[model samples]
Target: MNILIVHAHPEAQSFTTALKSTAQQSFEQQGHQVEISDLYMMKFNPVASQDDFTELNQPEYFNYALEQRNALKQNHLAADIEIEIEKVKRADLVIFTFPLYWTSVPAILKGWIDRVFVSGLFYGGKRFYNHGGMAGKKAMLCFTLGGRDYMFGENSIHGPIEQYLSPIQRGTLAYAGFEVLPPFIAYHVPYISQKDRQDILVDFEKYLKHLDELQPLKFPVLENFDEKMQPLN
Candidate 1:
């Protein structure tokens, strides 16, 4: 399988970067093709603006999604966006590697999504969830966090980690039609010892080797909803 690993971390020696490297090596050793987009190294622009398009559908009003659709149709997307979009299209699987920032993705990664997951292309109208443009593809998140596992849960201080991830996991990935896999999180990474971190890398390699065995996370099925997207009984 062709895999694209989008890595978003500023520090080269960070644990998150190690995880990204481990994923690439593990996948390649397993006979899969791999590509890495190191956002910080590439100096990826994290802002979505008129600069994203060579031309606009409506120059009078700056509606980002509308312009995205126009750009996709006109082949007018900025070169960087087109490059990332092609990467996404060619991959069978896309892994997002990042250090959790404020319970969310880094700004650069978020911008990558905004620009790459173009409107009218990735999704539009009801072409989402099970019926999104990326239906046959798959996506997974491999992120590192400073929080310990015990610090998150229904009864924990930080509440459920899933809640913090729903926007990206369900809203963005699942909503775009990719079969979203359960995330592999490296928790308390900063506080962990080098041995523990190495062990985590070993565990991660094992996880990558069994990608076929991972079940996708459940989300709203279009079949279960009425024409208006209201749930049907």
Candidate 2:
């Protein structure tokens, strides 16, 4: 299987980076082609603007949302999206690895989603989502957290970590026709000792193998579920 690992952490030495490498390495060892797109190290722009939609091939249709996006220009937004779209087009499995921040993805990663998962391209067209253009693709989220595992529980401070990914899971992946797999999370980034991290890596390798073998998730692209995904009158 061809897999794409999208990593968003900044520092290469961070534990999150290590996990990203481990996941990629395991997939390669298993003979699956792996693509690693490092958002920050690549100096990714996480902002979305009309320039993003600009078609060098079709200049006349240059989009106008660029002017409306200046407020977000301070962040590197659209560059990541443009690159990720290409990577997504190449993979069968797309895995997102990052740390949860303020109960959501880091701003840069969020920006990646905001830009690439746009209309017309990823969705919104006649017969756009019969089975979802990318519907047969698979997606997974892997995260490392600074808080204790207990804090992510229903009675704890943050609620379940799974709840944090609802938008990416339901709104993005599912909406785009990808199957959502249970995310792999390591809750106490600061607290996990080297031994624990090692064990997690071992478990992670097992899970990566599982992902390689599993069937892709299926969801058709539809403007609305009530309507048929295919063309209609």
Best by lDDT: 1
* TM-scores, all models, native as reference: 0.95, 0.78
Q: Highest TM-score: give the candidate number.
A: 1
In candidate 2, the residue pairs with backbone N, CA or C atoms under 3 Å apart (3 or more residues apart, or in different chains) clash, namely: 45-76, 45-77, 46-76, 46-77, 47-77, 47-78, 50-66, 129-221, 135-177, 179-217
- Shift in Å, residue 102, candidate 2: 0.7
Residues 1-233 of candidate 1: C-alpha lDDT, one tens digit per residue: 99999999999999999999999999988899999999999999988999999988899999998888878888999999999999999999999999999999999999899888998878887678898889999999999999999999999999999999999999999999999999999999998899999999999999998889999999988875356753211
Model 1 earns a TM-score of: 0.95
Worst 10-residue lDDT window, candidate 1: 224-233
- Which ranges in model 1 have alpha carbons more than 4 Å from their true place? 224-233
Q: List, in order, the clash count of every candidate structure.
A: 0, 10
Residues 1-233, candidate 2: write the lDDT tens digits.
Answer: 88998899988998889889999898888888999888898777776655563233334564433322331333423454546777898998899999988777888888777776655445554424344557678888898888887777788877876677777877677766777787888868787788988898888888877864655444444455545544321
